[model samples]
Target: MTATAPRPETSGPPALPPLAAQVERLVALGVLDAAGLDAARVHDAVQAVDAPGLLVVDRGLVPASVLTPLLRLGDRAGFVVEDMTDVDAFAPTDGLDVPPSPVYVVTAPDRGDDLGNWSPEEALPELAARGRSPLLLTEGLHWALQVPEVVERNFCYMTIGSRLRKADGAYDARTPAVWISLGTGRDGRERRGAPKVGWCWWRNRHTWLGFASGVDRLAVPLDG
Candidate 1:
């Protein structure tokens, strides 16, 4: 009998952007309100969380814990982490304005591939825990069929991606989730041949797909 060849191992470590570098890029985009940053905390977060894996969306309150680790990085970039809760509940929200730049990693909290993997049911509760009521949002192309719960929230979301298509020219349902930023994107879209939105250069890409109930726009008020 002929011996069978073994299959290659699939999946590897996530290639998330470097924390310090990503913070700098955000400053260049002019989204973060990098001022009066608690420098002490930024230093601490950088010292504590060294790996990119620690920042990717996962089952934990990393946002609350790790959000301030880059105060110096952000302060230098001219963007400060506001006292707002909702926008940064799921991910770090840069800038200090209503609807401040929300950095959504299309990478699911459980998986690392694309945004489609996450459903409203799975992500909403966490947002609520953080006191957010923004409409569940994602890439507009697959909105209607994928996340119908968007009607329950106030505003839609817009994010960037590179892993939605497959060899068969259909949506790659099995594809992993990716991390997105309603606020600022990563440093290498062209390098990876990713399909960015029309003339997008930063991570603060707030293109809402829907809204409702006296909510005229996507707003992230700083009540804290």
Candidate 2:
């Protein structure tokens, strides 16, 4: 039997860029163009927010389904696994209330590295009791877009806030996650070091996987 290494100190505030620069990064990635949005208008919407966190276009406007592919770390692009082609159908699970705004700020987002190896079943309620919310899949992507280091080796995190509802009305057991690929199995050698968007069973624990969460979410009105 092998022993797992002790967890390191949980990371401090994410290295997110300023609000205005975030918009420019989005523009450079063609996120604004894909959503038929103008850079100036998008910049104006969240200008009033002076906090340090991720600036995300609402999933309604630029669904994670559409934006995940645009995520890049170094020269490696992000991707969803083939088994999850219907990723868009995974909505915010019951009890998660994402605001109805075209844009929002994920206040004080952390990769939750301290929660690594805990199953989603164990992590979700833990987040709630702490007055935090698990980061949605899109939110995780936003973090990677802004600060790629958040998806580092041996320090990845899950996004259990989103789930797919079966026709029988029960939620699917697969919980989404973000991590770096070793380029093994179906992930080709060419994909080594790429940022991976995938899933894990809700009941399973992974030594390298944590539960990503945010202190709170604030709806940043486009009218601002």
Models 1 onward score TM values of 0.24, 0.92
For candidate 2, give the lDDT.
0.82
Local distance difference test, candidate 1: 0.26
Q: How well is each residue in 1-224 modelled by candidate 2, as lDDT tens digits? A: 12345876655435888888889988888877876777887798777886767887777777777777777778988888768887888788887878887778888787777777788898888888889999889888887887777887789989888898999999899988888888888878888888888889989889999888888788877653
Highest-lDDT candidate: 2
For 166-199, candidate 1 gives per-residue lDDT tens digits of 3586533221111222344442332232111221
Q: For candidate 2, give the lDDT of residue 213.
A: 88
RMSD of each: 17.2, 2.8
